[model samples]
Target: MRTKVAIIGAGPSGLLLGQLLARAGIDNIVLERRTPDYVLSRIRAGVLEQGMVDLLDEAGVGARLHREGLVHEGFALSFGGAGHRIDLKRLSGGKVVTVYGQTEVTKDLMEARAAAGLTTIYEAESVTLIDWETSSPRVRWVKDGLAQELTCDFIAGCDGFHGVSRATVPSTAIRNFERVYPFGWLGILSETPPVDHELIYVNHPDGFALCSMRNPMLSRYYVQCRFDDKVDDWSDERFWDALKSRLHGEAAERLVTGPSIEKSIAPLRSFVAEPMRFGNLFLAGDAAHIVPPTGAKGLNLAASDVRYLSSALIEHYDTGSAAALDRYSEQALARVWKAERFSWWMTSILHRFPETGGFGQRIQQAELDYLVGSEAAMTALAENYVGLPY
Candidate 1:
C-alpha cells in the first residue's frame, strides 16, 4: 500500500496534521503504537492558546471545544500571602485562553477522522522510517504479527520525544539541547469543585503549586516534588494537605478536598532538537521539542508546529514549490526557541531551587513584585501566557 504522506503518531499533533492535510485533499495515513483508548487515557495540558483554538476550528473539530471549554480572561499569581491577578484578555488586547484538556482535543480529532473516513492505524508495532533521505520515503510496521509497508512522498515524525521518528536520525546529523529540572510535578485529579473559577499559580516556601481544572466538577492540581519521588509516596490525604499548605488566604480556605482518581509524578525538562526537518522526514510536536509545562506551552507548541508543517506541505502540493518545505525547520525553530525561553523563565521564577538558598528566594519574590507592579512586565507575561503570534 502507498500514500502521499505517512504520519508516525496518533497523538494530537499527528491527528491535527492528518485532518488538516485531508481537508486539503492530501492523502495521509496515521500510525500509532497504542490503541485509541490508551491515547485518551493520558491526561495532559488543560490550556489552549488562541491560535491553537483557531487551528482546531480550521480543522472542523472545534464545536465541542467551544461548547464545553471554559474561557478564561485572567489567572491568579500568588507569592507570599498575596495573590495578584494578571488580566490576560485586557493585557493581551482581548486575547483569551480556553481551559480545555489535551485528551478532549485528541478525542474530538479522533472522532472527526473516523467520521471523514480518514486512515488511522492504531497499535501499529515497531514502526520505522525507511528511505527518508531519498525522494520516495517508506514506512514499515507490524500488526497482528503481519508485516505492512507503505511508500510515501513524505514521512511526518509526530510520534513523540521517545519515538523512533527523531531517534532514527544519526547522532552526527542532529544537535540536541536539553535541561532537566531538579524537581517533578506530583499531580492529582479529584472529583471536587475547583477552589477558584480561574487557575491559580502559587510560589511558596514549600514549593510551586498550580490549581487547574478539566470541568466544573473536576480539579487538576500539582505540587513540586523531588526528582526521585514516586506515585506511591503521595497519598490522597497527603497530597491535599501539601496543596493546602502552599495556597494562601481565601484560596486555601475555599479549597475542597476529595478522593484522587488519578495520580502521577511528571519530571520537568526543557528540550529541543534543532533543525526539525531530516530530509523527507519532518518532525512535529513532542517528537521535536518539549517544555517544562510551567508556562503551559507543550500542547500549544505542538499545534503551532502542525500549523507550519501543514501549510508548507499544502503549499508544496498546490504550487509544486519546495521553498516553503525547505524553510520549514528554520521557520519552526524561530518560534520554538522563543517558547522555550518563556517556559524556562516561568519555571525559574515559580519554583524553589536547592542551590538558590535564601538569597535566591528573595530575588525571585522581588522579580514577582516588579512584574505585578509594572504594566510592561505584566503585558510581557500576558503575551507569552496567552501565546505569542504564530
Candidate 2:
C-alpha cells in the first residue's frame, strides 16, 4: 500500500488528522489495532474546550456533538466543605466547554471517515513501523493472518503511549520527561444521575473526588486511590459508600447508583516527548505527550497537536519546503509544556499527597479556600480550565 501520508492509529488524533489532510487534498491511510466497536465503546475524556469544539464545528464534524453534547459555562470546585464556581464564560469572554466523551468524538469521526469512503484496518496485529529515516516510511503489519507493507511519504505516529511508533524512533533522538503520581483514579460510569449540577471537583481530607456526567441518565465519577488498587477489591457497596463519604451532604445525594456501566483504575501521570518529530516521522497526541486527567486537557491537547501537525504536513506537501516541518517540534512543545504545567498544577493542588500534613495540609486548604473566595483566583482557574488562549 502507498499513500501521501500514513497515520498509525484510528483514535481521534489519527482520524481527525486524516480528515484534515484529506480536506487539504492530501491522501492518507489510517490503521488501528482495535475493532470499530471497541474504539467507539471505550470511555475516556469527556470534556471539550472551546477551541476544540469550534474546530470540530468548522471541520463539519460537530453536527451530532452540537446536538448531544451538554454545554456548560463553568464547573464547581469544592474544598473545605464549600463550593466555589469558576464562571468560564465570565472569565474567558463567553468561552465554554462541552461535556462529551472522547469516545463519542471517535464515533463521529469514524462515521465521517466511513461515509467519506475511508477504510480503517482493525484487529491488525504484529504491527511494525520501519524506515522512518528514509524518504519513504514503511509500516508493516499482519492483519488477520496476512502480511502487508504500507509505504508513505510522511508518517504520523498517532498511536497512544504504548504504540510502536514511539518505540521505533531511536532513543537517541528522543528526550522523554515523565512524572508518575503515587495515586491513580478510580473512575466509574454509573447508570445513576449526576450528583451535581455541574462537574464538581472536590478536595477532601480523604482524597480527591470528581462528579461528572455523561448525560441525563449516566453519571461519571472518579476518586483518588493508590496506584495498585484493583477493581475486584472494590465492590458496588464499598464504591458507593466511599463516594458518598468523600462527596458529602448534598453532593452525595446526587450519586444515586442504579448500575455501573464501567469501572477501572487509571494511573495518573504527566509525560512529554521533547522534539516530537524526527526525520520523516512526526508524533501527535498521546504518542507525544500525556497530561494527568485532573485538568481535562488530554483530548483537547491531542486535538491541538493534530491541528498543528496536519497544517504543517499540508504546507510541506504544497511547497516542498521543510520549514514548517523543521519547526514542528518547537511549535508543538510550547503548547504541550503549557498544558503539562497546568495539569501538574491542578493535580498537585487538588490531590492530597502522602507528604502533605500539619502546616502543609493547612497551607493547601488555605490556598483552596482563597482560590474559591477570590475572583482573581477563580478567573485564573477558569481561564486555564476553559483553555489557555488556544
Candidate 3:
C-alpha cells in the first residue's frame, strides 16, 4: 500500500499531524504499536497553551475541549508560606490557558479521524522507516504476524522517545543533549475537588509539590521524590500529609483528602536532538525532545512542532515550495530551545535541590520574591506560561 505520509505512532502528535494533512487532502496512514485504549489510559499534563488549543481547533477537534475543559486566567506560585497569583490573562494581554488533559486531546483527535474515515493501524509491531534519505520513503511493520510495507512521500516519527523511529537514525548523524534530574515526581489522582480553582505550584523546604486537576471532581497532585522512591512506599494517608505540609495558609486548610485512584513516579529530564528533520523523516513531539513538566510545555511543544511541520508540508504540496520544509528544523528548534530554557528555569527555581546547597535555596526564594513583586518579571512569567507566539 502507499500514502503521501506514513506516520508512526498514533499518539497526539501523529494523530494531530494526520488530521491536519488529511484535511488538506493529503493521503496518510498512522501506525501505532499500542491499542487505542492503552493510549488513552496514559495520563498526562492538562495545561493547554493558546497556540495548541488553536491548532486542535484547526484540526476540527476542539468542540469537546471548549465544552468541558477548564479555562484559567492565572495560576499561583506558593512560596515562603504565602501564595502569589500571577494574572496570566492580564499579564499576557488577554491570553489564557485551557486545562484539558492530554488524554482528552488524543481522544478528540482519534474520534475526528474515525469520523473522517481515516486509517490508523493499532498494535503495529516492529515499525521501521526506510529510505528516508532519498526522495521516497517506506514504512514496514508487522501486524497479525504478517509483514506489511507502505510506500510514502515522507515519514513522521511521532512514536515517542522509546519508539523505533529516532532509534533507526544513525547515531553519528544526530547530536543529543540531555539532563536527567536527581528527583522524580510521585503523583496521584483522586476523586476530590481541587485545592483551588487555579493550579498551585508550591515551593517548600521539604520539596516541590503541584496542585493540578483533570476536572471539577478529579484532582491530580504531585510531590518531589528521590530517584529511588517507589509508589509502594507512598500510601494515601502519607501522600496527603506530605501534600498538606507543603501548602500554606488557606490552601493548606482547604485541601481535601481521599483515596488515590492512580499512582506513579515520573523522572524529570530535559532532552533534545538537534536537526529535527532527518531527510524525509521528520521528528515531532517526544520522538525529538522532552521537557520537564514544570513549564507544562511537553505536549504543547509537540503541537508546535506539528504546526511548523504541517505548514511546511502544506507549503511544499500547495506551491511546490520546499522553503518552509527546508527551514523546518531551524524554525522548530528556535522555539524548542526557548521552551527548554523556560522549563529548565521553572524546574530550577520551583524544586528543592540539595546539591544547590543553602545558597541555591536562598537564590530560589529571592527569584520567587522578585517574580511576584515586579510587574516586568510577572509579565515575563505570564507570557511564557500562556505561551510565546507560534
* TM-score (C-alpha) between model 2 and the true structure: 0.97
**lDDT, candidate 2, at 194:** 85
Write out the backbone clash pairs for model 1: none
Distance (Å) between predicted and true CA of 263, model 2? 0.6
- As for lDDT, the candidate ahead, 1 or 2, is 1
Clashing pairs for model 3 are none
Candidate 3 structure quality by residue, lDDT tens digits, 1-390: 999988999999999999999999999999999999999999999999999999999999999999999999999999999999999999999999999999999999999999999999999998888899999899988999999999999999999999898898999999999999999999999999999999999999999999999999999999998988989999989999999999998999999999999999999999999889999999999999999999799999999999999999998999999999999999999999999999999999999986999899999999999999999999998999899998
- Score residue 106 of candidate 2 by CA lDDT: 91
Give the root-mean-square deviation of each candidate in angstroms.
0.5, 1.3, 0.6
Per-model TM-score on C-alpha atoms: 0.99, 0.97, 0.99
Candidate ranking (TM-score, best to worst): 1, 3, 2
Tens digits of per-residue lDDT for model 1, 1-390: 899999999999999999999999999999999999999999998799999999999999999999999999999999989899999999999999999999999999999999999999999999988999999999999999999999999999999999999999999999999999999999999999999999999999999999999999999999999999999998898999999999988899999999999999999999999889999999999999999999899999999999999999999999999998999999899999999999999999999999999999999999999999999999999999999898
lDDT of 2 by residue, 54-135 (tens): 7787566899999999999988888877677788999887889999989889988888888988767888788888888889
Candidate 3 lDDT (Cα, whole model)?
Answer: 0.95
What's the lDDT for all of these models? 0.96, 0.87, 0.95
**Stretches of candidate 3 exceeding 4 Å from the true structure:** none
Top candidate on lDDT is: 1
The 10-residue segment with the lowest total lDDT in model 2: 246-255
